[model samples]
Target: MDGTHLFELVIAMFLAIIALHYLAHRLGLPPSVALLTGGAALAFVPGLPAIEVDPELVLVIFLPPLLFDGAWSIAVDRLKRHMFGIASLAVGAVFFTTVVVAVVTHVLMPSLPWAGCAALGAIVSPPDAVSARAILERVNLPRRLQILLEGESLLNDASGLVLFRFAVAAATTGAFSATNAAGTFILLAAGGAIVGCVVGYAWVKLVRKLHDDYLMIAATTLMCWIAYLLGEQLHVSGVIATVTAGLIASWYQHTVMSAATRMRGTSFWTVLVFLMEAMVFILIGLSLRDIVERGGGFGALLETMALPALAILVTIVVARFVWIFASDVAIELAHRTGLARSVPMGTGAATVLSWAGVRGVVTLALALSLPDAFPGRDFILVIAFAVIMGTVLLQGTTLGAVISWAGLRGTEAEGAPMTMSQAEAAMAQVQFAKVKSLAFDTDGNLIHPQLLRRYEHRATAIIDYAQRTEDYVPMLHAHFDVVLEAVAVGRTELIRLRRAGQIDDETLRELERDLDLEELSAISAKA
Candidate 1:
């Protein structure tokens, strides 16, 4: 492709993704699925040159932000509740997959050595962060199930990559030692944890010193890359480093960072991840072009498809089912014995989680990073791509059905339930505490003494609402009489305009959404 043509293709890709993403949101499907399908559709264009970006660059640059954002959003206490199942799936399942795939690959492909098989296995073992989480969240699976799946995917990607690196090193060097591998794993993991915490905490302290929202937000974006690069230079797992840093940053985020800083930082990171995800899918489509072009015929396809990829796919799926079921039983037993903190899992939730495991960009990036001169490199890449597309596109599309069939869709009570009054009071108190942190005088006294009195008044009003939850309806009627009347009048106008065709369906929807938010806030304020 020429420079102009390539630029045109890039523009077209974004336009297609944005338009299709809007459509998907309207249809209540995860927008990621639509973006993947939309990108792939562009591949059907005659003689359209494919867009090719370095997979290593994609992994190192794009992955940290996504993983970090995921960890940041995850509530520490809630994640801890599902840690048992998550550990089993993330660590235990990866080990199980490596052994299972190694055995099958060696037996089926006698020419391929154990190291080569192990490398392939490790690359395909972990589920992808982008596609899997998007589909799982859309199903609205019980909150426990959602957290367990998301947490498992987030950490397992790190663990699996760590394992993959060891296998690749062993393969390239023609040496394999379980003892050395185990020792290295421990040191690397420990080192990453230490570095991540130090870096994250240091960043927090620095942000507190500056207290500039824009600079604080910029520091977060920079932290993801810094953690990854530092971990890589130190020969530790960057994924683990990034995840740990995100967790640490989030822990201090509520207390240290200003509200404006948090808002802007969250928005920036979300948009960055969204763009990266779209580009990754488009890259996947472009990758398929290379695979097909290089293979060139039915015989090449048949050769690559022979046995190993199929075995890996089957093992991954079956292993997930077994692991989830066994872990669920153990968790239930623990809860019964008064040893567990979270609710025991149900059969339906386990089944949904098992089927929801989907491979994504991390898997693809690992494949593309394989040394071209390595023995069986072609086969390894082929199998990795096969596993990625099979799980991400096929399974992702059907995840909602699995959730529905298993009767696992709904918000499960994972955290301690908060009453309306309790939630409001807690929030109001948090705001008051943050306001008190502002420094104005030489000795860090209050910035505005009058602001303290106003905060007190606002907090008292919030406390009053909580104390009269039962009388909220009447209280709401009394507090916002004028606003409610205006909202009612505007809603009536929107309905009339829609019926008369003066405004289109889209215009009516915008008006309704704004009205809903206004009403919800008013109602919640009364409580």
Candidate 2:
């Protein structure tokens, strides 16, 4: 395609992305699903150029930042608190699904290489973050259930990719060694983690030295790529490296970032991640035309492989439910037997977790990476695509109803308290006490300190909220609403100041951003 055509195509794709995304929001559907469906429809349009997505390019461009953003934005404290459940779902269930699918696929197609079956299994094992996030946004799931699902989605992507790499290598070389694979897994995970931490810390130091908001944002954009590239160069797992770096960066984000950096960087990363997701998913959908032609027509291939593909998909779904519920049972048994001190998993939580296994980008990338000569490559691709579409259309669309059926719609599930992490009462009190000092200290006139001094005692509610005082929740929301109203007033005045030439655009932007942050915090707290 010529440059003009390529440019036009890009413009069209972006416009489609925006329209489909808005439509998804209106319909309470996951944007990834909407984009994929739209891309498939676009594939059949006459005169549209055929678009091919390179697997390596997809991995390099999309996985790093998306993985990084997921890691960085995740609540680290919540991750730790829900470590056992998250780890079980992310690590144990992923491997279990891989093995189950591999065994089932091999049985269903004994002619295919065992290694290729494993590769296929690894490809389709992990539920995707993009779809999961969309559902979570629309659903009012219990916080505990949300953490389990989100954390699992985040970590399992890395685990699934790592496993996929090993499986693909084994398939390519026609060799299988569990002992060697296990050792390599440890080394890759350890080495990648080390590389990522080094890169993350180095990035923090560099941005601190530069001290420019735009530069800081630019550097963060590079952080994930650097970590992944470095890890790949060292023969370690780049997926793990990117995830680790993101976590490290997140840990120091508050300390390293100025308000401007935080505001701008957040917006930049959100857009970047969303765009990459749209492109990857749509491209996968668009490639359907090529795939159909390559496979001697979709109908013929579907007729031949439909049963096996359905079986593999069922294995993937069933294996997740088996592993998670079994883990839940084992944990409950342990707690009852006095062998573990942790809270036992509730039935609702287990059921909700069991039903949320939808696959996406990692599966697409892994399937695409299969060499043309590899055994059953086309079959693997068809199966992977089928699994993605089936799961999203079935499980992703119904996750909210599942949550409702499981009765995990509140902060507590099955009478089990979802203990939220408490803010340090002292620290919160100190922060809120300075509302006047923070907002109007520069003006020397606008608002008196006494006007907002009443906010000081607001932080006292922190410990109560932490302790799950249901009655106190409304009062807290009311307080945040009042504070938000003040922020709106402050924002209007700040804009007026800029219009009247009392402040420059830069000053107005910075101050208004501070108010925006204040309003955001208030709204977030209320949520």
Candidate 3:
């Protein structure tokens, strides 16, 4: 495709993805899933010419910002707590999954080379953060479970990508070397880390010097994509660099950024990540035909796809169960040894985390990026696609079922009532603080005397309302025998009149809103 045609296709893709994503979100489904499904449909539709997706575009343009956003949003405290689990899952589990998938694929499909199988396995092993974040963040996984899953997902991309490089090299050269591969992996990982930190630090310093919110936001955004490109150019892991940069930059969020800069950067990054995530998934769905066509005939493709998908699905399920059980045992040992305090991993939390592991774009990108001349590339592509679809569709759809079966739903009660007195007191404090902040100048001199006096009067009324909150609980129980009984009575009379069609719709709606406020007050006071 030429520049103009490619540009138009990009616009069309973005618009379609955005519209579909909005619909999915409105319908209470994850926008990522919607995008993936949409992408698949777009690819399969007749009369649509094949869409050319550049692998370089994905690694350079897509991966970095996505990884950075994930790293940025994950809190340091949460990341630290789940550090062991994340490390184990990201570094260890991926390798284990890759090895297992490779061995199984080689044994099952003897015609496919070991190296090719390994490449496909590595691509499929790491769950996508985009998918995990979309699913897990919205669900009621315990704080700890959410952290563990997110941390693992965040770091595993680097691990998978690194392994992918090795796998590709092996497949292309028809050779494999343990020693050299291990050494290269370590060097690249370390080099990527160094580059990320140095670049991130420099970027933050530049942003701080500029002190322009728009410019800062733009620079940070550019850094995400730039880090990926630079890392790839250096032949280090781009995903690693992106994640590392995000972490380093996030560490300096408050220290380096002006308040306005921080606010605008945060908003801009959040929106950008959301849009990219939606687009990636949609593109994944749309590429179904690309995978199928590239893999050969549908009948032949299905035969190749079925075994690998089943193997991946089974392997993931079994592996997760073993990992979780072992991790739990380790957690117990740590508590016993006084290395950590015992924090219960509720059944719901554990189950949800296991089920939330959905494969996504990273796998598809790896599949598509495989060299055309690579032996058994078509088979590998089919298997990888199968794994992605099976894990995401089957596992994602049934995760909630597993959660319910395991009784993993949140224990926290929804919208629990609070006593009126407590609510009134809290609201009073907020009102008083706002008033005080407005009344006083930075030098401690009073400003706007007339407005200050009026504020003082309103503040006193808030204080009085706050005090009445203590009696609110009893008053509500006694049907308004204490504090503002007459006011409540008048409001009830107004509500009844409105209900009887004695007031206009707007007046009735206004009265209903007031009634809601009063009810909230009473409920708060009771709590």
**Worst 10-residue stretch by lDDT in candidate 1?**
407-416
Query: What RMSD does each model have against the real structure?
Result: 6.9, 4.9, 8.2
Best by lDDT: 2
Deviation in Å, model 3, residue 369 alpha carbon:
2.0
lDDT of each prediction vs. the true structure?
0.78, 0.82, 0.75
The order of the candidates by TM-score, greatest first, is 2, 1, 3
Tell me the spans in candidate 1 whose CA falls farther than 4 Å from its real position: 1-9, 26-29, 297-308, 332-343, 412-417, 426-527
Candidate 3 has what TM-score?
0.77
Worst 10 residues of 2 by lDDT: 412-421
lDDT of 3 at 25: 70
**Native-to-model Cα distance after best TM-score fit, residue 235 in candidate 3, in Å:** 3.0
- Model 3 segments beyond 4 Å from truth? 172-180, 337-347, 409-527
Q: List the residue pairs that clash in candidate 2.
A: none
In candidate 1 the C-alpha lDDT for residue 291 amounts to 68
Model 3 has a clash total of: 19
- Count of residue pairs whose backbone atoms collide, per candidate: 1, 0, 19
Off by over 4 Å in 2: 410-425, 428-527
lDDT of 2: 0.82
